[model samples]
Target chain A: MSEIIRLTTPLKDEDIVKLKVGDNVLISGVIYTARDAAHKRMIEALEKGEPLPFDVKGQIIYYVGPSPARPGRSIGAAGPTTSYRMNPYAPKLIALGLKGMIGKGKMSDEVKEYCQKYKAIYFGAVGGAGALLAERIKSAEVIAYEDLGPEAVRKLVVEDFPAIVVYDTHGGDLEEMGKLQYRE
Target chain B: MRVVDVSEITEAVAKLCIDANYNLPEDVYEALKRALDEEKSPVGKSVLKMIIENADLAREGVAPICQDCGLGVVFIEIGQDVHLVGGSLKEAIFEGVRRGYREGYLRKSTCHPFTRANVGDNTPPVIHYDIVPGDKIRIVVAPKGGGSENMSMVTMLKPADGLQGVIETVVKRVDEAGGNPCPPIIVGVGVGGTFERSAFLAKKALLRHVGKPNPDMELAKIEKIMLERINKLGIGPMGWGGTVTALAVHFEMEPVHIASLPVAININCHAARHKEIVI
Candidate 1:
């Protein structure tokens, strides 16, 4: 197995290009959270020339809607949601210099094209491993659309949050690569 | 006739909802362990390991297994000789769901289809009722996640399509879904009956133990064949790609009108959770 890569948020162009599909990554520092509802709102804000909840440049957005945190814990069962639901707005976000996205499932062709062209990367979290994944989140607070409840946009501090580089700037795809390697 | 209080029903439903979401069913937990042992890719094995560990943590912490705690799906088998009292059965079930989501810290995922507004308390569960011969009530709560539910479908094929058509359609559905539904998924297929009944069967089939064959020999054989074909797709664990894309393919068939051959496929993520109780 190849050595795992460690990264911090607000990823640089160098960080993205050095990665390949199937590479294990441990991402620390700050990452933003959003899902279908928040994504739509973010794009609408962009279209109206309104400021976004957070600056898009050099940031990572995790596609997750975590359960309500218990009394003392920072979060609860926080796993990545399926990524395809964000297809409509992903390209727009990528073009705006969003450096990384964390979610499960495949990206659309257009999303992938934007990732390659704009130097962004797509990372896959172990889908459905919510409770275990929640352990890595140091803190979380809703930054925008708090009324959206679980679908609200949150800013999170994560440490060694596990992910796999599913799509990279060089047009690599782990889903296809892994299949080719193991398919009967 | 045996008298059953609606309060008992409500309490049981509430507990089942919380239990199903917080604890992974033993059958599914074991299947993940077996998948971990058998998966070839290093990443796939790791993914499986994490899923197994997540279940353990959720149970120990008394937290939700997945944030998408799912719209509460209640399957009730009511005995013909039992008398229900104290309240409306449907209302009781909804109350149970509301209390469970609030008390259990489960996500309230139900919403207005077009408005996208959440129902807030996860009320008005998707309930299915069956009348049975005994004088008892059997309640099963299966929280249905949106990700996997989105990947499910129902189709009406001509009689000429037969078994081959069903298998091909199911395989194609999973292939197209890829990792969207979450790999190492349990595929529940409901064939024959009318369109809606087939869809109902598809969802109901998921309540079966993971990978256990249908009692009917013919369907069991078909399930084995379809499972073999699906895993060959190499969707692997969480679609990271490997040999264990699906842990099981469960097929349930019923008689249908000669003119219709309806089939529905309901995919459940590896969390494949459902808990039951009897009263």
Candidate 2:
């Protein structure tokens, strides 16, 4: 069994550090969705000193580009995307007070190092378990990059959104540890 | 000789597109159940359990199995004696995809190459067709997700590298892919064809039933060995780690130039969505 913890958006630095690799988290409150395209625009905005679409302080940005919501649905089957594509832009956002990332796949060594240095934690959601994960989201609204279609940045209110800590703030890696445990 | 209307093809393809997105093929579903029953790592078992549950929910058409509904990859085998009437075969397929994505509430994942602009209707699907001897046309719709497709690889090994070389290449691809392609992946290996055919073969191999083996027992043995070696890597379910890194390994081989041994690796996420129709 794994440790179950509840986390809210605009996550606290202290709370992030308390999460060790492999902890199970049920994230609540407001979270933002930003995939590869949105990350690019945010980095460009940062370089130009232009304002970001939303404040990054204490935020957990999920790497997702959700499918179109059907009639009367809050959102379509929303799930974490492969996070490695956003590696180039993650450390900058981490430096700008981003506390957590919810996405699937491994981060780069640079991103891993930055998570430790900047006190951010990277979590992995089930990659293909989108339909199941969508049940936890209560509301969805596009906030940026409307032209990106499914890749648009959306703000979502989630309740008990589940994830596993892949990279802890202290540079621990759950995947490596998990793999080693079963090695024969 | 047989006559078939392209409109019928369009309707069939549209339905297939939606069905493939919502439903996990029987073979894939059974393999996931087996993986859940067999996986040793507790975390791995938990992930597999979630995957099995997800499949049940996705079958209702409430939402696609994955957020990435995937590009519409269609494989067709048309009998030489059949007369096709109505719209262009290519257009019919795309039209089906367009209708499927829009009406089924599936994601439109296709995009223009350079600018990354959304293609809107998920049109201009990736399609392959071959002419066969029968009077019936067969179509298989495989919604290939980006996560796994991006991890696929192709290499030209020196013919002397032999079968061992091919095995090593596939195992390495899965190892490097790790958690990215989504674990308990179904690996499709295309061996010995030319560069292009090898890639196509790899993708085509994915259309095989997950638990089925090549009729060639020698190649089936290779697939078995490859599956065993891959599971030993401890990638497990969703890369959480366990004894079931891959549910199955399907390989298709063809003759190649004497000097070149080309091999391609295509990985399908646990969501391996595809369905077949014969007309």
lDDT for position A128 in model 1: 87
Candidate 1 reaches a DockQ of 0.80
Residues B1-279 of candidate 2: C-alpha lDDT, one tens digit per residue: 788889988898999999998899989999999998999988888899888888898897667899999999999999999999986988888888888888889999888887889989988788999999988999999988999999999999998999999999999999889899999899999986589999998998998999699999999999999999999888888787789999999999999999899999999999999998999
Candidate 2 lDDT score at position B206: 92
What would the per-residue lDDT of candidate 1 be over residues A1-184, giving only the tens digit for each residue? 5688999988999988999888899999999999999999999999999999999899999999999887789898899999999999999999999999999999898988888999999999988888998999999988999988899999999999999999998898888888888787
Q: What are the per-residue Cα lDDT tens digits for candidate 2 across A1-184?
A: 6779999887988898899988889999999999988888889998999999999999999998888887988999988899999999999999988988988878899989989998999999999998899989999999988999888888999999989999998889877887788755
Q: Which pairs clash (backbone N, Cα, C closer than 3 Å) in model 1? A: none
lDDT of 2 at B12: 86
Model 2 backbone overlap count? 1
For candidate 1, the chain B TM-score comes to 0.98
The candidate maximizing lDDT is 1
Runs in model 1 lying further than 4 Å from the true structure: none
TM-score of chain A of 1: 0.98
Model 2: residues with Cα > 4 Å off, grouped in runs: none
